[model samples]
Target: MGGGSFIEEVRMLGQGSTSSSWKWWAVIGGLVALPMCLCAFCMVSGLGVALLGTVGLMAGEVRPAREVAEQFLSALRDERWEDAYARCAPSFQGQLGGPEELARRHGGDRRPVEWSFSRWSVEVKNGVRQAHLEGTLTTASGEKYAFSIELRTRAVGSGEAWEIHAFTMD
Candidate 1:
């Protein structure tokens, strides 16, 4: 064969080898990259879902025990006996029967009273909540009584909505 023809043939073979190598490289790269991309996408989507769930829970379900307790105390302070009694946990209401019964049991006269919290703490266990409130209760007669009350609460439905379940004075 002529020298020029031989060189042309060699050049064509080199080109073909280069093209084949490039194709193989592209295939390997795609194989390695696909799963990595999928994993990254999954991780991002999982994080977004978790954040959304947390926000929904904070907005909907988890009622702070402190707020409920404060409202209950406010009702008592205003001498709204029935209102205050309504705020009590169902178990407590059942035990006391009614507002008049509760007042007699606690030695309260169904009159306005002042109360101050000395210490307070709240805890949640297995989705149930409990609050320990220690404070002084002052009657209209100027008598002050130190008491620690335990309040129990639980989430009622979807979201963080909560309702009092019980109350006990110790």
Candidate 2:
């Protein structure tokens, strides 16, 4: 009679029946599983978005050096010796005396000459910039010469300012 009274109390509380007990277990299981599923989904989606953003940024940032290289070649082609020399490193200018001296030493232009640039590439590393230029230089004597030149520059002070550090012909 005592155990029978406890069983009656459980039935009245709605936990003694099989269907009600199973319903409570299902609710607890769903509460535990939902958060884990949502967390895994967010992690996978965030990684995908980050990867795409990085690739886009890298492509957008690569054009500045190419533009600089083109401007440099154009100056040389137009026989703008002063402008071309201005693009050289200040240290080189001081060592060689001046741009005019540098031209006299390396310009190789006894008379009017024609020049064209080809096969150019520019690279930037650790705040230093380098450019490779390959082209043909035709003297007034009608002699066609092929040359490869490397130019190095560095960022000066703050902002986007750059200064040439060296120019070499090979």
Best-matching candidate per lDDT: 1
Q: Candidate 2, 52: how far from true, in Å?
A: 18
Which lDDT tens digits does candidate 2 get at residues 87-161? Answer: 656776687677567557555553226666666665776766566666776655676777655566554567453
The ten-residue window of minimal lDDT in model 1 covers 161-170
lDDT of 1 by residue, 43-84 (tens): 999999999998777544323655676677676666566876
**Each model's TM-score?**
0.51, 0.44
Total backbone clashes of model 2? 1
Number of colliding residue pairs in each model: 5, 1
- The parts of candidate 2 lying over 4 Å away from their true place are 1-81, 106-112, 156-158, 161-170
- Which lDDT value does model 2 have at 111? 28
Itemize residue pairs with steric clashes in candidate 1. Answer: 60-160, 61-159, 61-160, 61-161, 62-160
